[model samples]
Target: MLDRIDATSITTIQLYNQPFIRAFEMTPSLPTFVPATQLPLAIDNGRLVLQDMLGVGAYGSVYRAIDTQTHQTYAVKSLNKAGLNSRQCAFQNHEAQLHAKVSGHPNIVTLHKVVEENDCLYMVLDCGMEGDLFYTITERGGFVGNTMAIKTIFSQIASAVLHCHSRGVYHRDLKPENIIMFGRSVKLVDFGLATTEPVSSEFGCGSTFYLSPECQGGFIESVKSYDSAANDVWSLGIILINLTFGRNPWKQACPRDETFSAYAQHNDFLQTILPMSTELNEIVKGAFCLNPKKRITLSELARRVQACRFFTTPEFPSEASVVSAATAASQASFSTTMSGVYPTSNLHGPDDKEDSGVDLQSMA
Candidate 1:
């Protein structure tokens, strides 16, 4: 279960320019939620019985459940009925409809069904027996030297994103934690922050680590508008980095952060720290381009990910190289200037939901 952002932290704003619908924010907040034990046990009559609590998010809680009729296991995500406002209800409906739209891809978690009881809205999802990519990466200490593994995992992820885009849905949050793994295969989950619009000005909507500079809006010089597809591409690029090195590039994608400021100012700053190959470096650079318009397309990004061979050089970066890169980046003046600062952002890692421990035998 991906932890949904709190309702209080998010400001209700208009998402699009034409229709002018009020958009719900998926930003983080303090954990103020109804415990799973407090919710009703029986769902869809007495067919589904809720078991242990899997995890809790902002709007709801996910529980390991069993279908008594079929004797099959499932995870049920239940949204709290009493807490939902009109905007939150809109968000819930939008999430269900949009997620269902993009559900058939092999690498995407399947939405089995949606059941709206009088007290809760339940989403029956595929049980990820092996937890998420974040846990895998942490356990293995990253995929630094394993090009084959990285390529296989990333290709599936990119393929899933491409499929979503084709279906007119854009998953605003694309971090590793939102991806559930079943052995070698993975399924993308958590459409809580997704939008049907191709472009959005909903700045600071996603996790801080995977946000693009344009999305990390806090400066007068920052682009007021951003391409949603390009922003997703930027997050994919960060995931690529995580897959390769097992760590985030920076705390935030703004000039205020020293590491990000260096990368933004110097072209070679990433290579200086990480031993990225030329081809991989080019992909990263393209994905992280300051201008959203110039950012690489999702299809092209997938193509490049498949084409690239080595993600890193055979050797680690020399101490001297690191110093030189840092010095050069520090000397260059900050090209993007700042005016106002963003509200203090929560620095939490990607969604850390526990595995349901139920192996899904069905793919379709």
Candidate 2:
């Protein structure tokens, strides 16, 4: 789904996976959806009037809706029997179950409720106006120019992931698109790939570039059992690099990864890539280390990130830049392709312009 709505009038034909559509201009107002009809998507009680289509994927669509009773807005995800397999539909139900298990974490999105009927599924989630981290990164160029802000954002993410792990859960799908922002405050969303078991399945999962070295589910014939917590930490490291550098360090993990190997051969690798402090350098090394056994745990990583000077720095221009970008993101429309929401996605895409720089070898 795309945001092609007219803010002045809340009535617009919902477009699905359209290209070159202009972003929606939204303001605080009630929705005027097309006259009640039995569509694949719709909800009841409190007149849950579905508004703008926030985002759409291969399996389903997320819409902006309003609870007429409270006049409060929410992000509603609809799963229907069009263009989706049974497994994909199951993933949606799995996500709803996971959200129910862990809903009180401050940094994670709260699942308001779920509806079942019309041979479809509707899930109500907290509506975030500021869009997602991917858009913010694009608008800001990269976080390498804003080290303090990067630390600040990463610290929050580390804390959130740590909280998830503490509750015996793991967000297997940790990526920029899944992390929505509301100014400096951030919330983790989209738990379609989340799991409670150490290794949910032998097969691969999550976005390719963000997958842990051990969890190359798609590329490898048989993936070694992976600790979900460690997988999350590795993905978090990739996110830090992606946000700060605006590019992935390599297509895969190291020794095999040429770019990472080159960096490993150097002593000032972390600082060489970006102007990171010595303490921060150590943290980066711990997170990005080729050996997962030596990598820092979520708790340790969160503690270090929260205590870091860059993370604690307040009122800095670099930090303020994120707020500014988020405000812009709030106005612009956000999109999610069918590919993005899938379990196995091409780690390399058009947006990852530097994907060519890394050597993507056979995981087997």
Candidate 3:
């Protein structure tokens, strides 16, 4: 039976599921404060004329706004004051801090400035208009291309992940939605689920299907004791499988909550996802290894992806195909060269590896 939901009742739905208009209701009324050092923005002419709203989630709404002075487009993510006032403020603040710390990386979305309007926090980032990789791939007809194309796209994603890891940032939510593509390039977005250090206790931060086994266990207060980076690698592997097969690894599995656990314990689960390609199969298996220690690192994964045989394939004639072909060839070369230098076996095991070398203090 279709429930007769009214305008007032619509706001009760989760932000991700609600329409933009209904979700906008969740945004707190703007606060009045003089433009200060950290907060330099105002509702100029009574409207925040942004290019468009890219996405809205429990955390906030992401909009493409232009800097009038510089005339530069930027992604402005505004935190929902209601959610902030609730218990989620700490997580939101933590995410903002993480973005602030890793703001300058090319692969990572650049954070322009932070603003507080009406007690709500806003993060302005350099805008990328091409939308997310997930939507792009779906629009082009699921999983369209040769092995080389897959290798190239995966390598670009791996490079971004490597950048995050080098800085001790683990993108707990590594999926197509979070991967934005502009022209031929890709950038990682949505830091709401990212963390500088592992959550030792048991709190899960990512989407259900993409989350790692460890994250599904429970809530962990301390970030220093978990293998967050390794978890990110696992999610990346799942994403790779999805891209190659045009569907999730465990799409048919019952009870979505148990999917990760099932994948972690069974080799058949790995085998099931392998027919995509011998090379990509091995890469996914290594990344999805239940033992975090045994799983592949982003650096090694990047190398493996780059060196895959698919990269040697002939280029497609179309301009899009040509760009994809170039990206694949470049990544394949890098991966092959890197594999020789780092070697897959040298990666850290789940128990042996400590925190990533980067400091979390600044990110906090």
Best by lDDT: 1
lDDT per residue for candidate 2 within 129-189, as digits (tens), equals 7656665554433354455667678877877887888777788878776777765667888
Superposed Cα deviation of residue 122, candidate 1 (Å): 0.7
Q: For each of the candidates, give the backbone clash count.
A: 0, 2, 16
Give the CA lDDT, 0 to 100, for residue 58 in model 3.
46
- List the candidate numbers ranked by TM-score, top first: 1, 2, 3
Off by over 4 Å in 3: 1-48, 82-90, 218-225, 251-274, 310-364
**Candidate 2 residue 213 C-alpha distance from true site, Å:** 0.7
After superposition on all C-alphas, the RMSD of every candidate to the true structure, in Å, is 14.4, 12.5, 14.5
lDDT of 3: 0.53
Clash pairs for candidate 1: none
Per-residue lDDT of candidate 3, residues 153-204 (tens digit) = 7887888788777777777777766676655566777777677765444455
Off by over 4 Å in 2: 1-41, 81-90, 140-144, 217-223, 254-257, 263-271, 309-364
How does each model score on lDDT?
0.65, 0.58, 0.53
- Best-fitting candidate, measured by TM-score? 1
Give the lDDT of residue 294 in candidate 2.
79
TM-score of each: 0.76, 0.70, 0.66
